[model samples]
Target: MTLPTTEDRDPQSIGLSAKPDEEVLAHILQRQIVALEAARDAMPQIAGAAAALHAAAASGGKIGYAGAGSAGLTALTDCLELPGTFGFPADRMRILYAGGAKNLMTLAGVHEDDSEAGFKDFQESGLGSRDVLIAVSASGTTPYTLSAVQAANDAGTETIGIANNADTPLLREATHAVLLKTPAEVIAGSTRLGAASAQKAALNMMSTLVALRLGHAVRGHMVNLVADNEKLRLRAQRILQDLTGCTPDDAAIALQNAGGRVKTAALMLLKNLDVDTADRTLALHDGNLRPFL
Candidate 1:
């Protein structure tokens, strides 16, 4: 039977099961390298997707993610961290996966083929023209994922598709598409090893670049991070100190006055403003630190 590229056998690992441990690991590592390379090759598409999402965010739109199985989890990783990492509002992020939330941990692959389920889920998300949806499927043919993309697009929401194959419906169904084109896995048909990696790398770059574009980061630091716990709170203090050359004691005071908000605290220290004034300035600049600094 003919198979997709991701399901094809890797000739180098013809006797993979009989190989020595070191040789097996080496083969897997090579696949990982190829996956990363595929991600790198898709940077132009990633940049376009990031810009589209940024524009949606500026227009008060939400970001949504849709996928199935490993792809779904990889997409979740990006959506879940936006609030903690870049201080994105939690209400503005949404995730839809095959089999729904109850089956999240089980990852029932059968649900991936249910196109109607995907469409129904997106309909319930209340997506609108201001929203952006990212649909992920390594093979670019997962019925559930493609259905979500179709539903979102029909609703006037821009959809970005990420897949590992060219000329696939998933790529053609979206407003913007990212193709990772990773090689087949050493263990034939096991896409989680290579395809998943490429999807993750592409998602990482796209989401991080979007956050940076939104002024959530400055000088390689997370200026808009939500410092909820001790570790992040300490990191916020260090960020303030790094940005303003303030002492630890002063940083701590600023953080407290800013209510554990990293960006506001940094602005308070750098601009020598009180908490109220710092907040007002940050709001005026859309929470960007570069203008105040």
Candidate 2:
């Protein structure tokens, strides 16, 4: 059964900051409790999604986040960065927003209730049993998110629903459900404030920590990053030089041998192996190039 909307929270205790003006303080006092509680409440559902995603990746499947509005934006941010930062393939992750890619930059509101659109997106992506789907909505009633979740379930893909309201419809249908517990906005019902922040935090936990647990991070660094650009190229050089005491010039050449892969370059320098050896070793051990080096 769905829980009650808002989950009956106090809007005071959430704002713990003591160093703000009266106006700001009052605003915090009026909404802090509910705002944070909203995020706190969703932890369980987020945990489920994370677990499913980790399992899916381990089994050669993918993880996807679907939503509209702020939730969709945050998911997109996480998905696009998966490759450049952690070196996951584009197919390993996806963020399906209600509006198409064209609407990502424009402020035009997507049709939140477009169930058919959600189904089509899920279908086009070939949702399957190996995948995990995360559906986000502050109100717990966005039709697009709901449709996607339902489609994922039908395809045997695990599904997690995130919402601010308790006992929400989406929650009831999803395999796992978590409530954010955010109440009406400080300005009334504007969920963009607390709800959005809560969603970001939960998503951060899912992607960043999942990456870490799955060996995407090394010594707290994005070592498996794809060094395909000027900024990332420099980052690869710095990482290589820092790890192996190589000169800038030597690091640059090593990076080339490693095909501009920071982690691979570091492995080559540290292990004193050729690029081919480093590549083979890292591929053997799930890209933990540093340890292999």
Candidate 3:
């Protein structure tokens, strides 16, 4: 039987068990570099997916991520970080794991094949044409992930699929397929290594680009980050100080006047506007700071 590329054994690791520690580490590092290169080659597809996601966000639609096993965990991490990293609204995001949210803490492998569960989760979540769903599966044939894609399609949702194989069902079914096409893992079928690395890189590209398109990022800085903690509050102050030629103390005052909103505070400092005017300006500009600068 012909094995999938992800399942094939790598010749470099044939004697991995007997190799020295440094040599084994080097071998794994080499494969990781290859995985990153594969992901880089897929950037065109990732950019397209980002554009689709930006459209969905503009329409007030939620972004959903669905997957199984390691891929699911990676997708979940990306989904959860959006709110804090780019100030993407938490309510506008959803994560569909094979066994549900609780399974995130204790991964149960059996749920990876539960298609009915996938269908039901998407149904209950109310995914529709306005929403964008990103489905990830290293094998590109996980029944749970495919079922989620099918559900999203049935609801007229834009679906972006990320997989480590070519011509697989996950890629074939998705509206935009991002194929990483990385080589086999050092540990053979244990896809959590190389496959997961490629998937992570692809997702990072897609979500970060989407954030840039959404105006959450400005000049390589996260202008819309929520300053709910001390470290972030300090960072917000620094952002305003650097951008507006204000002292840290002045930035702190601006932050307070803007009610702890980093974007609004920066707007106030840069435009020399009062809190109310800066807030209004941000709202008028759709939360983007580039035009004001």
- Residue 113 shift from truth in candidate 1, angstroms: 1.2
* Candidate 3 stretches greater than 4 Å from native: none
Most accurate candidate by lDDT: 3
lDDT of 3 at 232: 91
Query: How many clashes does each candidate structure show, in the order listed?
Result: 0, 7, 0
The per-residue C-alpha lDDT of model 2 at residue 83 equals 78
What lDDT is obtained when candidate 1 is compared to the true structure? Answer: 0.88
Candidate 1: regions farther than 4 A off: none
Please give, for residues 1-293, the per-residue lDDT of candidate 1 as tens digits. 97788778888778788988998898889878977899888889999999988998877799999999888988888889888888888898999989988878788889999999999999998778999999999889999999999999899999999998888999999999999998878788777888998888888887788778888888989988877889998998889888899999999999988889988888878878898998999888887888766
Q: Which tens-of-lDDT digit does each residue in 1-293 have in candidate 2?
A: 63344433335434545546786767765565556665566676677777877788768787788988777776677778777777777877777789778777783665677999999899987668988888888878889989999889989988878787777788898887877766655544556667777777777787777778777776677877878889988888887777789999989999988898877788778888898888888788876654553
Order of the predicted models by lDDT, top scorer first: 3, 1, 2
For model 1 the TM-score comes to 0.97
TM-scores for candidates 1 onward, in order: 0.97, 0.84, 0.97
The predicted structure with the larger lDDT, 2 or 3, is 3
Query: How high is the CA lDDT of each candidate model?
Result: 0.88, 0.76, 0.89
TM-score for model 2? 0.84
Candidate 2, backbone clash total: 7
